[model samples]
Target: MTQVEARDSRGTEGSPDPESGTRRARVRRAVGALSRPGPWKRGRLLATPAALLGLLMLLHAHITDRGGLGSLVESMLPWFGVFVPVLLAGALWRRSASAVVALLLPVVVWLSLFGGLLVDKSHAGGDLTLVSHNVGAGNTDPAATARDLTASGADLLALEEITSQARGVYEQELAKTFPHHTVLGTVGLWSKLPLSDTRAVDIQQDVGPLGDAKSDDQKLPYNRALRTTVATDEGPLAVYVAHLGSVRVMPRNGFWTDSRDRNATALAKALATERNERVVLLGDLNGTMDDRAFAGITAQLHSVQDEAGNGFGFSWPAKFPVARIDQILVRGVEPESSWVLPATGSDHLPVAAGISW
Candidate 1:
């Protein structure tokens, strides 16, 4: 019945439980705070769109062509893989689980498609060496470009877009290093070894009544393809030098590469019917190997750069190469190494590959 007893009756008992109750309250508050959403939620939500787009791009091949534009994008489809790294950086910065998971989709798809090309399969030595370049129709310094390519220590050189004006400069400059050279129309082949059985390759886009055809009565020879046999230590190697017609993605025209595509088809057929088993195609194809338009050529030959180069080895737009319009495809020969040479005055950087029998 004293003060202690009165306090106990009022539920404010003189006990050691107040501190424990306060501790339990603080623990509950900490648990509640820990259960709240984190920064990763924002990243996860933001990554949904990109993940969906990645899924869509995975089926780029299935996308129907819209007047030849689809093939252009499909040809560079593997380039989209570059975005995955940027996405990964964002995911890491935001501590995102969903973003990271989404990134895996593009990574897998890209690797499955082009991982082999990223590998370094080049050998130590090669028997034959070659270089290919589009020496632009408007190149300002043909002599400089010729010197640059000649310095590459290649056994053979194939040039595209050799204008009548600049062809002389190249011919004069290259004559010292490449003793054996031939120019057929705008395309030309210069080799250190002896060349024989050289001829102009037809590149007319005659579609009969369906498409327009122009007569070459003047024999001005706008032919953009050539073939020659180069006698080397490894025997005769049949080489085709070509410059496919340029393509323009005009607003009205929409992937206007009709002449280029037609020329590609003709070139493919010519390559298919080649009598020589050892063949090398070097030129500015104006389309990538991934393009179905080049199926005929690709079916018979393999890209040396894709097989033996260190990286993507892009060679167009010498200032900032984005794609490898120039190429070196080979058959019945082993590619030892492939690489992109430094830029010259020309619009395109030269591409080179080494091979052996």
Candidate 2:
């Protein structure tokens, strides 16, 4: 036989091809390594952290609030996702099957908690458009803030942190858009519809240990919540406007939310006893709805943002908002759409929601 014939015969007889042999060997090695028990035993360090993160998200409510750590974590619970990618990178670098499997827990838990918020659930049109803003007490240009609010075309407006000095500016600037209005201490309600049964809600700001020491005059400034009735064509809609106490993070005390928690409890109680069938709460709650401290309030009213907003709708620290502390929650009404307004002259961006009867 000729040389070419001999080469064909050798190929047909399965002569060992170095490249093909190398490829088969590599495949076998990869399969063997994956099937081996050694990979499951590797990356214990990565596995431990991944397991802890999953448990933290799963049992965040069970975590103790001894140093207000529970509240702090819950407030930023959604952000816990930042660790998942880091853990995944480590798992990939280590090529540990166990670490990759462990990561499934946190991924599932986080998605279960906040995945819905990532979707857009809003629809067009509603009976009333309500806007709530903190309006910052230190706002230098109250007139401009009021104008921005008026431009929102809201049927009802709730303003919190309205200082006595700038109150008149807001009143003057917003009067044309919102004809019927009431200012109770620092909290106020402005509406195109007639308002009645307007009164200050004692959110127990002056009933606490330190608050008890203050006189009536001193307690006047702490009046940061109100209740009012807006006579809509549908019916008399009970409205609540509130600015819960500020939260602080101190080196010694950790997450200091005593004041805000007290206010939330008091507000929840008030909501529990509300006679009105249709209720709407608009405010700067000073805490996210996910925090356990608002369990009482959250149990009664569902957030419009959660129901109808496009995203998380975080409304605090307008320059770089990281949380949705400003809220419009409702009971006995349908939320049509929810959105965050443009930044005003305050620290908070206004939140608005349209509700139907």
How high is the CA lDDT of each candidate model?
0.82, 0.90
Q: After superposition, how far is residue 99 of candidate 1 from its true place, in Å?
A: 2.7
Task: Tell me the tens digit of each residue's lDDT in model 1 across 1-357.
Answer: 555444643246655577677888999999987896565565875488558657756777677667676677766777788778888888888888778887778778788778888888888789988899898888888999999998999899999988889989999999999899999878899888999999988866432222235432223347788999998776788999988766767565577666677788889888988999899999999887877778778889999988898888888778987788899999999999999999887888899998988
Q: What is the TM-score (0 to 1) of candidate 1? A: 0.84
Tens digits of lDDT, candidate 2, 1-357: 656534443255558677777888999999998887586777879999999999999999999997789999999999998899999999888888899999999999999999998999999999999999999987989999999999998999999998989999999999999999999888999999999999889887743234335332234445788999999888899999998877878575677787789889999999999999999999999999999999999999999999999989998789999899999999999999999999988999999999887
Segments of candidate 1 deviating more than 4 angstroms: 1-44, 205-221
Clashing pairs in 1: none
